[model samples]
Target: MTATTHTRHDPAAATLLRFATAGSVDDGKSTLVGRLLHDSKSVLVDQLEAVEAASRRRGQDVPDLALLTDGLRAEREQGITIDVAYRYFATPRRRFILADTPGHVQYTRNMVTGASTADLTVVLVDARNGVVEQTRRHAAVSALLRVPRLVLAVNKMDLVGYDEAVFAAVADEFTGYARRLGTADVVAIPLSALEGDNVVAPSAHTDWYSGPTLMEHLEGVEVAAGSPDAPARFPVQYVIRPQSGAHRDYRGYAGRLASGVLRPGDTVTVLPSGQRATVAGIDVLGTPASAARATQSVTVRLAEDVDVSRGDLIAAGAAPRLTRDVTATVCHLHERPLRTGDKVLLKHTTRTVRAVVREITYRTDVDTLERRDAAGALDVNDLGRVVLRTAEPLALDDYADNRRTGAFLLIDPADGTTRSAGLVGETSAWGAP
Candidate 1:
């Protein structure tokens, strides 16, 4: 029933676990996060005192632990979280970066932005409200974003009398739903965030629950270490050419490899131009590397001086497809509707080009997971499928196969505000396209 103590860590040897919290409003997500931090001794004394003073000002007997995460003034005033709140904490096992996302339906876009890069997502389920619509909605989003691991924290167990049957029923129902949503794994835990039971330590009240505590599960779950699932895709972010640096004449392509591995001797093809050349050398973060793995920022020198620029993609092999027409699923974030014939800017990996909405197929209802016929336009926060035609050819991969290469953003051409988050290729019934 005691919290685990952190051991001395060599910074280089520590593994970082980036996770996000999601659930319906009033599900105690922020409270659970606060409990995780407080029980783990991650919160400083000053921070805890500030929360205590704030709770006293509001005439509360217990400190509002949610105040630790709901840092915005408007959030404290309205008692609702609006934006994504990121917190960092470290344990002996791993370093954690937790993203506490808003639970309101209107702020679903914020959850998407948070969960996009998460290694794992912790979904809080109120023990009283077992598997509500919003719970299902958040689960669907996790599946759509392809988050590797999921933890179903059935919070507020004390309120439910710490009943094993209640926890079992909720976990069972969600397990079935999550499997259908295409989530690979789900770890269920029963806990009370307010009382700090089963969060950082084991809960004696729920002895029937033999599973690992919330902290135990989070620290133990396996996450892919930037492993490549598809072919190599190095989108050119900057073309480096020093006029008089090292005897001059150094043309290196600078970009982060989105997927797959790149070696010094590998043959790469510049997309849209179809120019082929061998990689002469690679510099990974200023260190000369024989090869570079996915997600590494590196500069590559090609054997032949091919005409490549910021908008071009240097891909390995013939796996990546180059096309002007893109069939993708979009989660519309803007209040202004996205209709066919709307001129927009499509931003894929480092490239942004003018594009037109070719067609609106249908919109997937997030709550019910239904593909309703699109009324030729997508409203705010509507998940829809559409086709887009860009002014230039782009090298794209199926999002289901590759998250980095298959993802894109749709921006308003007039004001340059982001309009939607797009995923290339068809999505499942859960709006994962």
Candidate 2:
């Protein structure tokens, strides 16, 4: 047997958790990220030395802490993060992949791309500034993305003398606003990212507050294992079949479990066709599973032959509702603008289909949290309600119900680049047609 055939037996290997950081300009997002890396000892000694040298060149009293994360030369000069810089670190508890994203008002698309796969979001806020427009915008994006957990890291607490009142007010303001956007669990913690207070370890300065440190909370938070409780949504990527072997009868449906659970003996129905079959085998990576849960990319073997193809979804419970007409709230992140009647491609999970923008309902003012009607086109960083008519039927769920099923990204068909991020919701009458 070949090496590929021999190594397909092990199932439990490693787990990956992705998280993102967001906040307004100079709110210490990159600083907190640098601190996390610095405190966790994830940075190399050589890298630290380089950053220190660069800091000294700038004539700072201390290392310009932001230097640790601002990798691009232009970013350092501009003193702003312009792209998503991903860093990895681990403790004995769990492995983490952190996407340190840009915080400028113009880079909302980059934020969406980074946060799309994140299980949690940490929105940093300056304690002195209570809550700003970007704070609300970040929180709104977190809610729209269906990020399971939200951590309001109120940074620069020391600047406010670590006063409990300042922390309380900022926390209350953010918590109240987040609730309006449907964030279920919000944890607020005050810290000075630059001073190493309450980031990885607890500081004695805040005696009135008693909560787990950021590191501890990250280690203990229970992330849902692959959305197994949701209805199974397997977007068929490819059909596996063997042609020239003694065991030539092998045929499998290969795809990742987008949501819900699938067991070997469970009966499943394929969407678009509604054909049914019994799952005879489940293969994770290459190893077979007696049962398979959500988020696992496994190849499934059916007991009976069935006609199935790519872009088709298979499920055991009630299938995701199929629709060609969709209304959704979207964040326009493309350099090019979005206008009604524009043709584009909508990619949801593993499936992509042609779609046309039917209407632009209203643009959301991130600063005031107000909806502006009579907007002509959605510009970069603009959030608006949109309606789309697809050329093909999509198996979609409410974003609040199942994020993996309800969320989609719009792609510009001409260049094959993503143009917008959308969350399924209700429609209005005022959108431009």
Candidate 3:
């Protein structure tokens, strides 16, 4: 099928895109990423030379492109990616931050970390193998995390003679599965990462295909526009007070705006304290500003000294639900099992409170999309639901409504090791029931 063509965008005025790559082991993810960087002229001479020397030491005539992203020594020796390797590069039409995540099933937690903040995820598939179990797992994880876009990269097309029929079958099967998982925006492309086909440029071998190259699609895909209409959420990180200065009485709450816009005269409420105040002033980088938007680190002066402190949330417009009971979908990251009645520390934005797991509702089988009910415990890499009761009240939004304010971490209070990553609210179709 021919893909729609987009108008060429200007390179100088392009925006940044954050994307990630994931697939089963040996599906050529790292090689595809390396080729994307090399062909786009994003690689430096010294880096290329290092890769070449490493390839020679391994007794290879040609450079192994996978070496570019497999930075860990154990990974290089094992010929498998164990951790997520992040790379930044820019094309003429766009800039990108690419996270090359591990393809091994045991390291699925690493994939979650890489894709948590990604706007898009490229799921690679070897033409010979089609869509495997790991591929479905990655797609389910992406769907659960609410990754807006997906790319079904059919790699190793050369091994299948670049046959349109082979590509079509794989794409159709994967697309149907992704749609079932509630991932609607999926684009499939046929390419050979080893031969550099349809990656940075179109492939002559696939003359029947008339789709935009991977680079072109990446350059033109729409990213999520900032949440300007959502209610403003700013978690107070620090309380700044001047002792000896022209502004000795300057009192401001310092933190990055998590969402929406904050402006002078805007009415806000401090969470947990339930005190109301108006935004008296905004200071950006020591200079007074008229307004502050999402992600901007600014100090906001309140009209009333409402006894705000670290771990407090300053909200505008709509108020978040303040509660001690939280039902959340979580992915266990630690080897120690998370069981009911286990005491853990829940770390939300700027706030850490003691919590106990009340129940393990169920565990979801990613491959089958089935819910295993009455699960007693969650092992490492398990996706499940949990009911948690905290010692103090927390102001929180649903993960679907606000990712920044709705996400949190569960930590082992004794050693401070992060045990799980959680999202507040009900599970989606692909997640726990």
Candidate 4:
């Protein structure tokens, strides 16, 4: 997004899992996250001591694992997550970046922000409370965001006697509902976050539940398996030209590869202008590289002089579809309502340009998954479909096809504030001319 901030993913590590944790109020999301950290020995002894002291001060008998998270003072006092808290932890096998999102319905936008880039989303649920409205709402959001993996952690199994029937019932229901939303491969695990059962280690209480613990599954899960084979798509973030050095004549397009792979001597096109060029060299952070794959950041020097600049896309194939009129699914993130005829700035890839809301098609009822008629104005956290007319053509792909090239951010032209995250088209719905 132009005015929006994207999470800075770690430089392409071979085995890293980027995941987000979400659930309804009092579902023990924070406790579960803390347990995942504490049981795995990822939390330092000092942090553990601090949590213990805080727990003792709060008149709790045991060290509250939830205290390890819930970092905000207000959150500690109220015992509710109000904002997204990110934590990084790793094991010998794999690395992890966890985004702990909020549970309140009003804070739906926060969940969207956390889960936007997650390779997997872990949605916790209380065994005492079956599938709830907010649970369904979050599952739908994960599916809508095209998060590759889905997990249901049936928490508080101790309170429910660690009964196999109880966990199975909750898991079965959630799995079915998530499948209806197009997430077919959903995994469920029973655990007690507070008592440290089946989180990082296997629980003795669940002899009947024979599945990998949350930690094992997270480490073993394939984060890149969902990506399909496609031609290389690189967006030019910056053009490099040394002014007064021996490399003064050297020019390179520096950016992260959105998809596919690139190598020296490969033919590529500079989009929005359609100039042809060959890759004379590939520079990976100042080192000469023969090839670069998707998600890797590198600079490519073309064989011939070609006009390229920020906001331009470099590709090896026919190139992404260019269009001035775009229809998209949007999640409004602010108090200011989005209405038809509102002029805004659209930020896609490295480009930001003027755009106008042509029409409001419908707003989705998250709880019911129903498309309601034009609501005139979209309130905060409302997901809807709208048509937009941009002043300039954009190179875009369907969000379902490619997350990197298909998603965009809408910005308020006046204040430069990011208003919403937009997904270009869905598998169904949205009637665009």
- What global local distance difference test value does model 1 have? 0.85
lDDT of 3 by residue, 164-230 (tens): 9999999889988988988878889899998999998999999988877899889988776457899
List ranges where model 2 is wrong by over 4 Å. 1-16, 72-82, 374-376, 426-433
TM-score of each: 0.92, 0.89, 0.94, 0.93
Q: Candidate 2 residues 1-433, lDDT tens each?
A: 0000111121243345689999989898878888888888888999899889998888876776678876742553564423677788886666899987778877787788788789989999999887898888788777767787888899999999999988888888888887777775888888999998999999899988777678767766767766556777788899887667764887888888878888888888887687888889998877887777777778988898889887788878887788999999888877789999999999987779999999998887755656788265798878898889999988888877776778898999999877888988642122223
| Range of the 10 consecutive residues with the lowest summed lDDT in candidate 3 | 1-10
Per-model C-alpha lDDT, please? 0.85, 0.80, 0.89, 0.85
Decide which is better by lDDT, 1 or 2.
Answer: 1
Residue-level lDDT tens digits of model 1 in 333-373: 88799999999999999999999999999988888777888
lDDT accuracy of residue 88 in candidate 3: 90
Quote the positional error of residue 429 for candidate 1 in Å: 5.0
- List candidate 3 stretches off by more than 4 Å: 1-14, 73-82
Candidate 3, residue 38: Cα displacement in angstroms equals: 1.0
lDDT of 4 by residue, 1-433 (tens): 0011112223355388899999999999889999999988899999999999999999999999988875652553564323677889988777889988879898888888889889999999999998999999999899889897898999999999999889989988998888678787688989999988989889999999777788888887776733335778899999898657788787888999998888899899888888899999999989999888889999989988888989999888657888999999998987799999999999999999899999989888878888888667688899989999999989888888788888999999999878888999773332222
| Candidate 4, poorest ten consecutive residues by summed lDDT | 1-10
- In lDDT terms, how accurate is model 3? 0.89
True-structure Cα RMSD, model 1: 4.0
